[model samples]
Target: MLFGTSGIRGLYGKEVTAKLAAKVGNAMGGAGRKVILCSDTRQTSPILAGALAAGAMQSGAEVIDLGVGPTPLLAYATFVEKCDGAMITASHNPPEYNGIKLFSKGGEYSKAQEKKVEEAVSSDLKKAPWDKAGQKGRKDFSEDYIKFLIARVDSQAIGKRKIRVLIDAGNAAAYSIAPRLFEAAGCSVVRVNCDKPGQFTRNLEPKPSTLSESAALVVKEKCDFGIAFDGDGDRAIAIDEKGVVLPLDTQLAVFCSHMLSRDHNKKFVTTVEASLSVRETVERHGGRLFITPVGSLHVADEVKRQSAAFGGEPCGEYVFPFATPCAEGLLSAIMVAEIFAQRGPLSGASRGIKAHHMARTKYKCRADMKGEIMRKISEKPQLEGRLSTVDGLRYDFEDGWLLIRPSGTEPAIRLTAEAKSEKKLSEIVQRAGNLIMKEIESAH
Candidate 1:
């Protein structure tokens, strides 16, 4: 009940509540010294964070609250303070939802650890004595986190390009960091909807429909490119200078190309849902690509397993183990700038990446019925293509692929189809979507 692919997330005051937060925190059962605690700008973040801290305190763990900021800051703080951390953020979820993202030993808690916590959440455990109760404090690591970010990039090299950039923080978590990260990297940064609070002015998801205005601004201002972040700043979607939203696969392929050129490591890791372009780019560049089940934790775990130097998802989450294990969207934008500086324009890097016609659609399916629906789908007649059930059913062909997976974080079935031709891609999506809907109906 307390954990999912990422963490314990749900609609605030509903599936997620102060009571559940405390229970889960107690179940986490670690007296992590100098535990770093943080939250996003969601109205319920503070109350949830407080409940989480209280739970940890009961376990004799001190809490160091890092106020409001993106999740990556909390990740970075864990490294600096050599402590565990927790960020109360529902990430890209809608404003009414919130979550708890736990950090341990420098990265997210492992699935095994999460299972233990889940078990604890179900059963009560001993609490600390009154005299041994944990302590609570506060820290302002925003400045240090920014300083750390500035030191990681070649500011001089980035400044040489004099690149102008547009940022749409979505009135979410990155509002405070995106601008600073770019400006510090010597890029002229323009921002929109970075200040409104208590409500997200736009949809929290960084999709083309949601970022249309930001994309238009890039073209209007003649900015080199635009970067948009989700509610928690972990997912980043890019818009090109021509006002076209850069497809997630294209971003992954371009960045993977950059990492491949460095010769540091010939290894890249990505989610199975990633576009075929990313896989081909990595292979063609002499880098071995490892595919993991969807989820940032799964990607991070695979990266560690394979000692991959770089990892990312098609959805714009990048994991550079050099900085921290968690995905960092703001840093990804800076990395894009550095890539542009060295590679001239993103078009140059993207030119080698072939674009595919892709369609993504979602159908509402209750959480309880998702499993049976998938089972029905698996039992349906086979297609004339290779099928992979690693994370979901992915039918692969030479020119395209289709992936149908239940959303781990939402009550919906996600359908993704891609092909070299638009008409074929649409047919694939439509056919698969109809089949799933039928199964969902049959289950009912």
Candidate 2:
């Protein structure tokens, strides 16, 4: 499929090109359709964005271009403007990579929607007549998006407490807006790596390994906490007061716990790859847990379908259905600050949440061989657990579970196994690794 779990993403000039972007735009265009378009800070973003706009215009789709904005902004704009949305971003991928993400009704395109686009891209798409072609216009909605967030959050409480925060935009799309959003919310904002758009001083993905510098700054500056954003600002990673970066699963659990505490509705959504800790914590709060395949698109769709209180991924992508349908990192950051404002420190909230010993590893597999390799592995002997093949192969055991799946965004197979005890986790990991390697060898 041209579309991955999230959107159509790959290396810029190779897998993702201007030609492809234009084709996608043309395929998605229709008469009287309004599409809100934006791009991240990648050098090639402008080219792709323009090509997409051109194609859409040729097909009679009115395009409102928000030249350089984050993915969250594009999503919000789509809802506010009552139009479909398109964002040119590779998300957390490296600089050489770029991709296009399409949104309809304020969320990523559903799998069925994506399938239609793929089919149209392959076929001969029609264009509008000379006078019937659409027009392009420009506007900046950064301030409006900031206002929308501020209106929903406890800005007064956040400001009253004067929560000091360090925001690491990673020199990408969120650089401009995040600082402003936090400052408006009454936070004493400290900015780093927010200077330039295309110049990156750190790894784009906001993980523990990539956030050391930001974490240290949070401690040194005596801030309440810190937030680090990924390349396109769709994901956020938090740094605690003591310069420790919170684990993705732990942070997700904390967010869920906080949200459940706020509303009477206990419907929460998380992905299949989420930690057992998340499930336990949600259930403890009398929240109903819903699991979907490993993608924010799936999470968002499930959230809307079930009227979920909140949805999040272990990777820090959170969807606040009440505020917007998209997985919003900017909103997640502000919500973290509000947690401190309404409650106490995050350290206190994270105290009782359990942590598990989990092992994760990936094996390289040729992209074209993924289907055959997965088929061979699925045909192998079963493990001792309840099995699920929702996104991949998952076996749930009494004390732990094992999951083996092909990476949706890369040419590899990922294995995740978790257990109550370290020894049990190690055993599960060993067995899972052996199974994957044996199948891969046979396929080769």
Candidate 3:
């Protein structure tokens, strides 16, 4: 029943299972309305998705299956078809895990609505009479998705360049979508681990360590650029044509710069986890930067309310508000491609952008200790920092900041630190982790 920073995610069979997924579906309700559903290539996803669809049908909701695509594809489909949606994927969680994420008609879900869905599932509400059962159908929206992406860019410009691109799907759902999009955009694609509907060939996260194979592929293939997608394909990490991995902050700056320069007066929304440099970049370009709590949902919600041009997290989740009200890897990739086409190599384009050092350290603090740790951190008046309890406890200092929050799905706490240097970032992260551990031990 745990909902993480994204959605309901947990270790499969242990905390998440088909039966529970079905219950969640029933709670969300199909009500004879079309509901778009999709899943990644996780081993347990199809089973859990089937149960979820059954429950939705039992609740008299029609299901449109967008098979084995990213969560954003499902989100896009939900908006295109004007249907509520659900995606069965644990995103960047490990192979042993799976999850379910619900989206409203516009591919966005608020915390309040998420709670409603959770409560509905918890209550075990009954389905409508059998005579009102909903139907199920299937569709391959990948082609349409590609077409939509192509429409956003000047295809002629991209084709003229004939960019050589390397793609690492991370054995996630993007295996089917990314290569196709690149090819359709007239890029000569060099693919690695692009297999769809198979075992995860790499660590689920698309971070640098997990994407060494991608980097090697980029260098070996001499590709123009490299891209890596996480499990559900909502987040993307990029490797320059030189086979250098671009940090999230630099990537955001690139995206924001392109967006703002192309369309002035656009607002860029981000979380506190975003580098302070991003805020400076946006402001320098006559655009405003809106900071929210850490989490895509929070950013997405703010984007919708403010009609912002773009939104993203430092962790690589990028959202184009004009496209859909959710972070979309496909869309972000297309935007990156356009940036490449317009500005040449990524390395050349990323010049003059302020770069900062950041590090994330996670600790195993049981769920029971989270509250005590929060209290102890809050009581430390000597900290002399600005504190935000938005997602968890985030303390902002003059030169750095740290966020300590309980993992929504795991019995652990996530600690993120950002500063001017790696040494300082690491020092603050370790200090925060130690202090939290001490509090937990004392409480126990």
lDDT of 1 by residue, 320-357 (tens): 87787888776787888878788876666687898778
- Report the Cα lDDT for residue 45, model 2: 96
Give the TM-scores of the predictions, in the order they appear.
0.95, 0.97, 0.94
Cα lDDT for residue 89, model 2? Answer: 93
Arrange candidates by TM-score, highest first: which order?
Answer: 2, 1, 3
Candidate numbers sorted by lDDT from highest down: 2, 1, 3
Cα RMSD for candidates in order:
1.8, 1.4, 1.9
Q: Candidate 3's residue-wise lDDT over 1-444, tens digit each?
A: 356678888789978899888887887775657778899998899999999989888888888888788988898788888878889988888888898998886566777878888788778555768788888899987788789878876688888888898888877889978999999988888878786455787887877787777887798898889998888999888899878888788898888998887775578899877777788888888888888887888888888888888888988988776677788888888777888888889999888798777777677766667777777867875444688887787888888888877766566777877888788887787778778777777766
- Using lDDT, give the best candidate's number: 2
State the lDDT at 397 in candidate 2: 85
Query: In model 1, which runs have C-alpha deviations exceeding 4 angstroms?
Result: 29-32
Q: Give Cα-based local distance difference scores for all models.
A: 0.83, 0.88, 0.82
TM-score (C-alpha, index-matched) for candidate 1: 0.95
Residue pairs in candidate 2 whose N, alpha carbon or C atoms collide under 3 angstroms? none
Q: How far off is residue 195 in model 1, in Å? A: 1.5
